[model samples]
Target: MNKFPNKIFDIVQEDLMAVEKELYSIIQSPVNLVNDISVHLVQAGGKRLRPALYLLCARGGNPDPSSELLPMAVAIELIHMATLVHDDVIDNADTRRGRPTANARWGNHSSVLTGDYLWAKAFSAIATGAKQNMLKILTDVISNMCEGEIIQLQEAFNAEQDEADYRLRVAQKTADFIAASCELGALTGGMDNRDVMQVREYGYAIGMAFQITDDILDITASAEQLGKPVGNDLRQGIVTLPAIYALKTSTHREELRRIIVNQNMSNDDVRRGLEILYETDAVEYSYTQVSKYLQHARNSLPITLNGPVREALLSIADFVGLRKY
Candidate 1:
């Protein structure tokens, strides 16, 4: 598998390989289709940032992570995969990670069931190897993720949705899972409560910034770079940070609002909206917000976090802030 040469990933290379092996082994099933779909998603390219964070946090506490750490990382990644499958179904998406989504390849019924299977497998692994507190944190993250999805659906096409609501939704949908990964890893690795909290806060900040950057990419990145349709969120009536900022500050707010509310906006309409967004510098504005969160993430790290692992964590934060994909 190809790995990014980012300093963070280099430091945790062996642990990440262990995570890959665990992910492959844990998803096996007697039923061929189940194994096929599960493996297919696993083989599909992803950064595996959450698992890396988990492993890195573990390393922060102990140079050689306990055997349980790998399984925990696998479970965290499985939870993430489960969500992506369900999200594709909800979005009626055709592709993800430059390949056909499970929902697109297998029918919604099968896809939904496969996602459930992943969730079951994830929880099963967690129950066997992780502490009760870690399980509770994972459970809460899942709940918050569901709530975030619901909020997005509820507020879809509502042009008046404010920044506060957007931030809350981002926190629940993306930040919580990232936070749990760090917290659980830190706890399992024998970090004190204070250090665990610090890492969790760091994860939350980066997670928020990550999602904001994703939203920005949906506007600015090409379809090839995004591995899915660009402007999809807008097409689905999901108002994002750029649109929100543009609506508040741009002279083209009325036009943007009209286009957004229109259920049948064409590609040209989305392009026009993009033009307005660029004119208002909404993308830059949103990027500024991302920078603030990145700074917060760095600030959340304890001073004792100063070795190579700490540097890796800090570099990961920088990558999240600046990554194009």
Candidate 2:
């Protein structure tokens, strides 16, 4: 547990419990398997970052707890969870958060159907308020996320992935979710166009930073800390920022590429590949790159935001950079 400077960290547990209860209620279905699969993954839990973004964005305008806001939080969480379930299937990951993945436990067919079910459930929640503009935005964000994943698969281990390509992919796949969460928050809080755009920009920058840090951690963090296997991205053949950096800058780039490209590498081969990344300081270099985005995120906040809420958002940007794993 990182000691977060923001008070949101203090209240995060309580808010998550609330969100979880609400999520459970919304997931109720006539089909027991869909309900079971969704709830299992939901309760298995991870950082509820998207919902927190939604809540913070809502609080920025009006600190009051509203019915609409809770549903929006739930919607964001379901979308996030749905993504995770689908991602594990795509990655063929056996475990997540130290437990068998939904795809592993319930089979890929069930997990895929469950993910689709949650997506529908999330849209139904969004439709409760049914702002056509908001729906359009959410739809666009989801579409972009899918496209990002597709592009990532296409680019995997190409040895030619650039900063621009990586940034664009992460922005759509990762940042869009955060942006949607923040935008939805502002929308429910009655923000105008300027504030909404500001929050969206803030989310995009921070989300990019977050994913970059995740890439670094994949190389640097221990499996215990990561709650999944280390080098998970590399294992999937998806080269992230650090891997791309090492490919460009490391003296051992050819050897590393050989290990990955040849496929069927042993654990020792993966270890050496990781060691090459460390020798070249790719992890540290990746952190430096992420810091630039974190700063950009801080600068993106609306001038109107100040006080604890402002500080909380800033702390979130920092937290994204500083996560140990």
Candidate 1: list runs displaced more than 4 Å.
Answer: 1-3, 63-67
lDDT of 2 by residue, 16-45 (tens): 568889898988988888878877887787
Q: Write the per-residue lDDT of candidate 1 for residues 1-325, one digit (tens) a residue.
A: 1244556677678878888888889889999988888998999849898999998888888634345677788889999999999999999999887799998888888889999999998988777767777788889889899999999988888898989989999999999899888888777767888999999999999999999999999988888888899899999889999999999999989999998888788999988888888899899999999999999999999776778878988898888877886
The Cα error of candidate 1 at residue 29, in Å, is 1.6
* Winning model by lDDT: 1
| Candidate 2 whole-model C-alpha lDDT, 0 to 1 | 0.82
lDDT of each: 0.87, 0.82
Off by over 4 Å in 2: 1-6, 9-16, 63-67
Q: Provide TM-scores for the models.
A: 0.96, 0.93
In candidate 2, position 197 carries an lDDT of 92
Clashes of each: 0, 0
Model 1 CA RMSD to the hidden true structure, in angstroms: 1.8
